[model samples]
Target: MPSYTYPVAAPNRTLTTEEIHILLTNTRVLARRLADLTQMRFVADYLLSGRFDATGGGIFYETGEEIFAADAPEAVAPGSEYPKTVLTAGELASARTVKWGIETDITDEKIAQQGQVVVDRALARLANTVIRHVDATAWGVIASKVTSTEASAAWTTPGAALEAIVRVQEERAALGTGLDLSTVVLAPAQYAKVLAMLVDADALPRNDSNPVLDGTLPLRAFGLEWVTSPHVTGTDPWLIDRAQLGGMADQTLGSPGYVSASGVGIETLSNRHKDDKYEVRARRVTVPVVTEPMAGVRITGTGL
Candidate 1:
């Protein structure tokens, strides 16, 4: 077997910190690292499935006590016609659909010096920014529409978090919304506590074979899996029935010549001869709304 883990020739000289400092940004590792956030777009789409194809500037929905009321069938005489119920229109609500975009310029000289990877990197960076914004917008809408419920001391206290989660689950069942809240979006602090709680309960083995010891949290509890978002956080975590929570809308078509990306609106690249640079622009027109208020409940004060 090779001694330094890999076969080996010994180093001719020591790799001093002084020499490493010179090439730190470009080598030894990638010069840049993107944000490593938990993937939550699926969660967004699941909770907000109202996607429309039009790039129209406005979106309208109806809401009210009557529209949202759960109605049950009433029995009548076998041969009689069902009693007529007066139809009442719910209040109309409208939201403006907004366009979000980003643009950057790349010069030929920079491309020559740094290669096309530089341009690709710029595109990737800007694209991720747009995606992050989209998620943030959707999460913000959900957070704002949530019904605030009981607080919990789960973060620092063992056995306290599960009770809070159960209580909200019960409260939601009591509402008779006909939909069950299936997921909880937790914060990092609360998640750590849960890992400990699992080990304490003997649900996870306390050994090297345990996933937790290897820096992983593999767990399911109360018939639901927890979710976490860097953007969607506070003292309150959301418990939502993704299928009934809300929706999002965005425009699909672009002007005659612009390029298109899936789920993103329009993108265009053009050579700016006069300026000696290339311009890259992207736009995503989207709107998110919470139509069913009863579909989500906030687990308040858990981070505390």
Candidate 2:
């Protein structure tokens, strides 16, 4: 009692409300950038959900036959009725959760200033992992559903590539499905090769009047919109009707407050405890399906 005074405890300097806002903003921006870097999100339809549903279905019309009428005197029988076909998506056997967490020690002094950096790193990791899953799913759908694979060693030439795409279009037309092959998605290397060949052939239109040249490759030669993706893997290119691709996301999973609670779908969260540690997490439930196998064509063995 006569001797010593207790040392004053240091005041807690945890991140303030403003700093938290900044950290979240930065994390969101980084996450969006990662999404933009990958083509899967852009090419495939994206769905957001609050809940997960295992089964989904879509409907299509069967091709109707044309009846040729004989002379006016001859009676023509009515064409048989065509029934609508139903395609049910396979059950979503599983949901993928991509998440990351960060912890800062209690003694750390730069939590406010460096919080954004920590959050950014975690978000970047989450974004990349999610994109990889999405790309893999899309690739699988294309591989399993494409009507045919056109192998070619002539992809280096614009004419050859054009011919390959045209072949797909012709096949689809022959099926009389009326599914327009409007999008051409190629692996990065193949896209570059095609671009060079097109430039050499002067197939790209000139727009000297515009100060900025369009970096997008022109696909008018094949009557398609060109989309290049690193995710397309291998030497194959996919010609597809975008409408036939199915994508679903659990809306509730990615909601703003999902991190704290656990339910279904995608969610993100962050928190700090009395121990002076920080944490973050992300989760999602999604799947991609191909409603029509004949709506896509895969051109392979391009020798790229």
Candidate 3:
């Protein structure tokens, strides 16, 4: 059997004392929230059967209620005119704010427990928001922040985001007796290329790779599974009813078999559907931080 060293090696980026201190200071909350959002996106799409369309920090529009009374002969019920309205996703860069402050000054065993609490709360909120937004008729299907700790350290690289996903999966695995990595699914961008690299490096199997199941691995942990988002347009396009459309619906068509009822308007429904990609960030709590000490690091020699 190949002997494995303690604290198995993993890739990491070095941070200066000033950076580390900042991470533990007011930035800790932001880091935690970013971690949560990263993981939530993974869970929502992979673990669950729903699709997550990225917004790329772009704004989106959603419809809302504007009351309108129905025409009646003699009876009247309480209702407002224009019963339905639209609600657009506000600009992310402008509307959202990230706040962070060290909840505790100590960094002992309590650190892990406290961090877990913070992570769980943010993750719960993220999951709830994504599901609610997707289910809402006004919002239709869109993606935004799952959770955010702060803006400073939101994920900028694929690797950082991937690691955050692994951390979340490992925690759940440890709690359950018979659980496996497959309970969670992972899909990465540039997955096929990454897989080829892994194969060349002799890290992954080259033949018969399979799509990952949920929790079976970290989201983006495997190079074989990748998910692509469709292209979306408009600054913030809300779903409008066909009737609300007027002269815009009466424009002349140039393509054959794609004309309107009067052969005047172009066919809009035949266009390919697309969605925006949201900017996401991911962070890990364990990289580089030695939360525990090892048994020995010194050698003793007899005097001779």
lDDT (CA) per prediction? 0.57, 0.50, 0.26
Better of 1 and 2 by lDDT: 1
Ranking by TM-score: 1, 2, 3
Candidate 3 per-residue lDDT, tens place, 1-304, comes to 0111122222254444444334334333443333333322322222122221222322222222122223323443567354343443322221111111112123323334453344334433443343333223111122121111111122224454335444544553464422232221112333334344444555543333322222223213343233321221122111111111110001122333221211110111111113311111221110011100110011111000
Candidate 2 — worst ten consecutive residues by lDDT sum?
A: 1-10
Instruction: Kindly state the number of residue pairs that clash in model 2.
Output: 10
Candidate 1 residue-wise lDDT at 181: 76
Give candidate 1 misplaced runs (Cα > 4 Å): 1-46, 53-55, 64-72, 87-89, 153-160, 188-221, 263-274
State the TM-score for model 3: 0.20
Candidate 3 lDDT score at position 260: 20
Whichever of 1 and 3 has more lDDT, that candidate is 1
Q: How many steric overlaps are in each model, in order? A: 1, 10, 38
What digit string (tens of lDDT, one per residue) describes model 1 on residues 1-304? Answer: 0001111233354434333222222221211211111112234554576665434777788643353324455788889887666666756877777777787876767665665455546656666667678768878888777665666665454456667777777876776657677777766666666666667777654563354655433234557656554567675666777667667776655565355543333344333446766666555677887777777777666654
**C-alpha TM-score for every candidate:** 0.69, 0.61, 0.20
Tens digits of per-residue lDDT, candidate 2, 1-304, equal: 0111112222255546466554444535323433332222323332111122433322222221222222234344588554443444433333332232222232123455575444445554554455566556657656765656666556767777777778768876886677777777777788777777777887766763211253433244445566665667677777777665444433333355444222112244555445655455555444554545666677777766
TM-score of 1: 0.69
State candidate 2's TM-score. Answer: 0.61
